[model samples]
Target chain A: MVLVAIILSACAPGTPDEDSWRVDALRSIGDVSSSVSSVQLALQHHDRLFGPYLQTVAVQAEDAAGTASTKLSAVQPPEPYQGRSDTVTSALDDAESLLTDARIAVVRRDSAAYADLVRRLKRTGDRLSRIEDRIRALPDDRSRP
Target chain B: MKKLLNVALGVLTAIGGFVDIGDLVTNAQVGARFGLSLAWVTLLGVVGIIVFAEMSGRIAAVSGRATFDLVRERLGPAMGMANLLGSMGVTLLTYVAEIGGVALAFQLICGVDYLLLFPFVGALVWLVLWRAKFSVIENLFGLLGLALIVFVVALLKLGPDWSQLGHSAVSFQPPKPEAWSTWAYYAVALFGAAMTPYEVFFFSSGGVEEKWGVKDIGVMRTNVLLGFPLGGVLSVAIAACTYVVFNPLSASVDTLGQVGLPVAIALGKIGLAIALLGFVAATFGAACETGLSTGYSIAQYFGWQWGKFVRTDVAARFHLVLLLSTVIALGVLATGIDPVQVTEASVVFSALALPLTYFPILVVANDRDYMGEHVNGRVLNVLAMFFMVVLTVVALAAIPLMIWTRMGA
Candidate 1:
């Protein structure tokens, strides 16, 4: 309960130029959610060979990335990307749900379900990474006359 | 000579039974997270367990009453009931996790699904409780759990940078990328796992069941003081192995496989096999202890007969609770939850529930009416008071950290 409050209060209302940043944040969230799903799927198959090893790596990466996004979320919004903060927030919601689903699958031992969720999550991640990449490539609207 | 052997056996059982699934998982997790930075917590926990276990054993020796029995008489019904509920819940959840842990160990060794082994594991645990002699049950798994020494062996094989580990132990700072909240959270987990309530409940109750008297106090203290720190050594070895293997990579331990990975790396397949056996024996033994403890606390609270010293038909209700608790634990595991994760959560909850049990014990330990000459001295009193305060603060921080870290993410 307290965590939810912290996360909510930490998330400031999106500004105009924050659109691309928000998109990047949402995409990163999606990527992490997908990665968790993939690891969950691998674990479900009883493939002890590499499943746990992979999951360990994946979770570590996701945690690092999530921390980064949280930091990025604190930065000021850029111009031109202003109104899309809501879109980013909604994407974060989706990402959180995906991650939650992955956790549930792990607890339930539903490997098949985990695999399917991972595939969807990966696609979501790919889309987000692409969006993030595009945003990084975009010119600063603040400098635009 | 026979008496000497019995004492030796008793000490071994105490050590084997001391470190359960909770200790195994939490020690590994903390080792992976903080290296030896929080090793002090285990040392602190070892001292706490020894002090309380000795007090409980002494109380049972003097009064012929188990810990919970004294709890009810000392604290009255309302407060006793509250402690009973809290301790029983944490112990029972741990019981469930141990059952799962045993099955997971079987899965690792036999290449079969752990869920498939769950029923057999549950039945085997029940049978031991039903038919095995009290001393035999204590001696058998208690001695067999020595297989966990493989952890110590593995630690030797890994040959960690001793100076660095020593440095981390002395110069404690929360590791990089980890907030103080999370570091504090794992510390509470380690402390709670080491000083779990059931250990005291079982220790005191077992002393009474074995009919320990003043003469046995020496042996009991030996078991508490020596056996627990030895158990802590095993815990340190586990954490050290995990630290050497996982900490550098920034990997979190989420499964038993990860817990055993360091052993596997150090000692190869033989090491893995031994560690898995240790896991099974530790968890299986704990399943019996916690299963029995569930009944022990409740029956003692309500003034009912309990223990394997009595026949099944004699303590029907007590046996019924034992059977029911095992079944419920198995059912929870059958739902496919990771026993490792369940074990982690159980330890965390145990942290939350520590004070309820410890406070009453501290009070009872100080009471001359019960403890007589065995009552805590000034030094023991000061230490107990310090732990009580530490426990309270840890309990306060546990929930908030769990929330903030999303259960450590």
Candidate 2:
């Protein structure tokens, strides 16, 4: 029974389940979050080849974050949950804007601008992380005893 | 039956060369993003490795020489040096990645940081290289690598849509959103992982280690014909596992733990146990293989006697290269670089280094003086030469595509 439920959940596609869209939306943001941090790791390691291509990474990351935010916002939520969804979308907005700044700073090798953006990116990352935890803890539709 | 079983070297090379750490991660990453669309690259790589491994193995059997040895004799000193430098550079990079890969695999089970496990893994690799007999090393890890078969079972249990997978395999486009560059980059990485230069160096060198003669040619053919393709299947199964589990969620696999998630989901803890065993065995086995190949390439290039079969006292240069390569690998990992990144770079670099070792081997294989009657026939030569072109194109495209895709994002 447990295995079947797991399999069914895995196979379900864009169902009308209350948390379905948010779960997928939040997870996509998490993927982008993971990719962004990997880029940061590459830079932190002073990886000359991949890390230094900051403009390209920032542009790409910005586009992904922007698109993810758009998608997350497009998903209609129940009235009571609208604020939480907006909070998540707002985090993505901050990420997208900072990534844009990161691109220019990275291109100029402007340490001050890049440092400022990094600070903002960290805060936005923290909020998105909190939102992800909240969304994951949302009750599974069928899990209610 | 016994002669067929003599394919231990081939099987060992398959486990390490064909489906090592680089292949495991790259295949899963591709599958998550591209589905089985890149499956054809794995197939192409399988055929390419068989052709070259057969030639190199035949050269060792007929000429009593390994690849680097004949590379110098046929291509002369300058070209040999270039080959040595290119091949050894990638081999050493691969050595570092393989050691780090083993550490990563062990980390999956023990929860220790891979950097901390480097010393133990490196020590174990060196110990096996130093103390274990050739056949013992080959058979032990090779058979254990069969544990990766858990992937096949998990895939079947997952019951993926076979027709959908087949359709993805036939389509040439990137799944969506991802550009042609990411697809092309991974294609080259997959190709490079499949036909990694160290595999040829290790395979030919292992042939020499076992002291194969022309009579052993049949066994070599069996290994190439049978053992290698099976290894490619292991690669595909890994990709399919990811495609089934992660593709739906749009989740990309960036870590080894996630690679095994589908197996656990399908077969529970027992499956996880077996997959982890496979990971350790495959990565540990490759570490030993690559650590030795580092020695093999340098020793063979300089005309210094080298082989695990030979005493360390007699092959001091070879053993020293092994020790130095291990230390260098440990140094790189200690810098806290991601082994997964090293794994990605190693495969792409292998694509770049392919032409260096391959061109000379093709020249040597056709030389009647070296192979006697075992020379490549006209048909096989045409096929081998064609794949050489394929390898060259992959070499040229690997770096640019990696950059354009930001290392596949």
Candidate 3:
């Protein structure tokens, strides 16, 4: 019975308070941003890396971004932070989508497509960094822990 | 000259065998996040492992018994059983991680799913353990594992601001945007990866396997003292490489593929190829060691007559343990769980298991019945005592910190 309860608790959606919810969203954005940057860097070095290696990294980045997106999306934000939460999730969705496209380019060994994908990845990655900075600058609301 | 050559081989193997899957992943993760700030923990762990490894090696050489054997005899059955369970659980988890790591390394080369590669990697490791000679397993993989030195070359080639890296190495502070809890969590992980309990078990048992008598003590000390520190350097180089390429971009490293990116950027295709080879050799070699260790710990505890020096038919139960462990590891990896996550959990749990593993070695190393005149000297005793306290504290804090930091998130 105890084990079942523990498992259920773990599997249940996390309805974190506003402060902690923002923190989770921020972490998700940072993770996806980092993964996007990694894919971008790998794509830039396409000629220097083995095709399989490049494809593996791209797939890994896509998985990372996808996982981050899913995790943040699962969290139930406090009422006041719903709009902000949507913004974070939307940005994460964008990052994950871009990473999926990058993984495809890598698997297809579409070098010509990489230059364009690289541009989009950089823009998404920069947007993530900016979101991360904005979130980090938010005032602490430690009262709601 | 042959004696010198033996010492040289021992040292090189030590350096090559030092960075297993745990070290590679943890060091890279910590590096990409904190730069070299947590490097002191690795150094501390190296010294700690060196201290205990030297003790365990001496015990095996003088007593002609492995760690588990002495542990059972000296600590009594109940305590020994406790130690065995704790250490064995961690070693087995590490075995699973290493097998998964080997599969992941192959995945990078062939772009095959690591889950699809688990059985093949597990079978290959078991085949080596069953058929290969002990020295063959140790030397070939250890030498090939040297390819990881590419990380050091990559670090140098990246031409990082040495002074900045050196400052971070000494500062012991987490870079901003990271919590101290996370920093402490990775510190424990890094320490656990460095001084994994299995290294000592494998070292002492290998001593017994190699028939290290009193005469071989000098050579054993050379290997532990010289090789382990250099291996620790390879670990630091890995971290520095990630720091140079990933940290400034605020990029986190969560995959083996990201771990190799710095090398590709630094030295291009050739360097990345060598790095991949290093990953395969290191993880494969560690898989063999951890697999054998699972067998060694069980057989040593039960008095079942184990060692690679003996034929598999002669050590039937021991070989059986090895086979079962491989299957079990493969079974765990088959869950489609991420190997990197398994590696992370294993290292943290390794920290939690360290006290149970090392306390027995310390006790037996000081026992006059086991060591005779070869007992630990005054200076060595003080150092060992210090590490015992540190290991105990690390073990106590491991679970709580792991929970608090959410596996270093």
Q: Each candidate: RMSD to true structure? A: 7.8, 14.5, 2.6
What residue runs in model 2 are displaced by over 4 Å at the alpha carbon?
A1-145, B7-17
lDDT of each: 0.75, 0.78, 0.91
Q: What is the DockQ of candidate 3?
A: 0.57
Model 1 regions more than 4 Å off? A1-145
lDDT of 3 at B295: 95
lDDT for each residue of candidate 2 in B19-138, tens digit (9 for 90 to 100): 788888899889988999999999999999999989999999998889989889888999999999888889889889989989878766665557788899999899889889987777
Interface RMSD of each: 8.2, 17.2, 3.0
Q: Write the per-residue lDDT of candidate 3 for residues A1-145, one digit (tens) a residue.
A: 2244346447533557766687688879888998899999999888889999999999988888888889888889888676677778888898888888988878887899999998999999888887777777665532322
The lowest-lDDT stretch of 10 consecutive residues in candidate 3 chain A is A1-10
Checking candidate 2 for backbone clashes, the offending pairs are none
lDDT of 2 at A113: 60
Candidate ordering by lDDT (highest first) = 3, 2, 1
Q: Against the true structure, what is each candidate's TM-score?
A: 0.77, 0.77, 0.97
Best by DockQ: 3
lDDT by residue for model 3 over B228-257, one digit each (tens)?
999999999999999999998899899999
